[model samples]
Target: MTAVALVLLAADFVTKQIALTHFSGSDPTEALGGLLRFTLVFNSGGAFSIGEGEAWFFTTVKIVVVVAMLVVSPRIRTPVWAVSFGLVIAGAAGNLVDRLFRAPSPLQGRVVDWIQLPHWPVFNLADCGVVCGSALVMWASMRGIRLNGTRESDAPAEAGATERTAEGRDR
Candidate 1:
């Protein structure tokens, strides 16, 4: 999981650097005709540029998320949970880097977003990682999968090991 997170963070960092170097002074570069393009944008807000001046608030949120994930990661008992959380943390950290040091000022730096799609908001690799990771977490929870690698159906039997009977003895 740590490896996955590191890889994702590295990838996002490299790609953003490339975008900054190559696309910063140019018009939109089309990757696919009328479908995909790379257009440099410095966003100071949330998704789709909402709340465009709230960089400090967003930075605070990212810090909380990263710290919470770090605190919880050691207890992750399943590969699935690890991967899901890793991706999320990687995504958060990627953008957090920008918010902390990229431009403007500390906790107010703008995120560099470039990838664009037809009729969709411009976004970047970090956003992709965050959305995909969150979806996986939601799917796992919906299917009654626990973070400890146990299904809900199996929990009763597992709990029996620690359960006590009315006689005050382990079942």
Candidate 2:
């Protein structure tokens, strides 16, 4: 989990720096025959530009998420769960860094977003991690894979079942 988080965080930081240097104040650069574009944008809001001018609120939320994930990480024995947690941690931390250090003052700084696709808002690698990680979290929950690496079916029998079995044995 640590490895995955570190790698993703580094990747996000490096890519954002590159984008800032190359794409800032420039028109969107086309790629993949116009299927993708690098369009630099500094966002002071949440996803899709929602809650504009609420950078402080967003920063607080991201900090809470990162801390909560870390607190629960030790119990995530399942590899998939670990990876999902790592991705979320990295994503939240990635954007939190921008909020803490970028510009316009701490906790009110804008996040650097560059990648763009047709009919989609300009986003960054951190956004991808958050979206993908959240999907995995949902999948694992629906499949009954617990954080401690146990499936629901593998757990001990319910208390009622155990009581019924004991009653029969005493007959």
Cα lDDT of model 1 by residue, 1-171, tens digit: 798789899999999999988885268888767688898999999889988999999999999998998998887898888988989999999999999998899999999899999999888999888888899899989888887788898765655554455446633
Q: Give the clashing residue pairs of candidate 1, or none.
A: none
Per-residue lDDT value at 62 in model 2 = 100
Candidate with the greatest TM-score versus the true structure: 2
Off by over 4 Å in 2: 161-171
What lDDT tens digits, residue by residue, belong to model 2 across residues 38-97?
999999999999998999999999999999999989888888998999899999999999
For candidate 2, the C-alpha RMSD (Å) to the true structure equals 3.1
Candidate 2 structure, TM-score to reference: 0.92
Backbone clashes for every candidate come to: 0, 0
Candidate 2 at 116: error in angstroms?
0.3
| lDDT score for residue 29 of model 2 | 90
If scored against the real structure, what TM-score would every candidate get?
A: 0.88, 0.92
In terms of lDDT, which candidate is strongest?
2
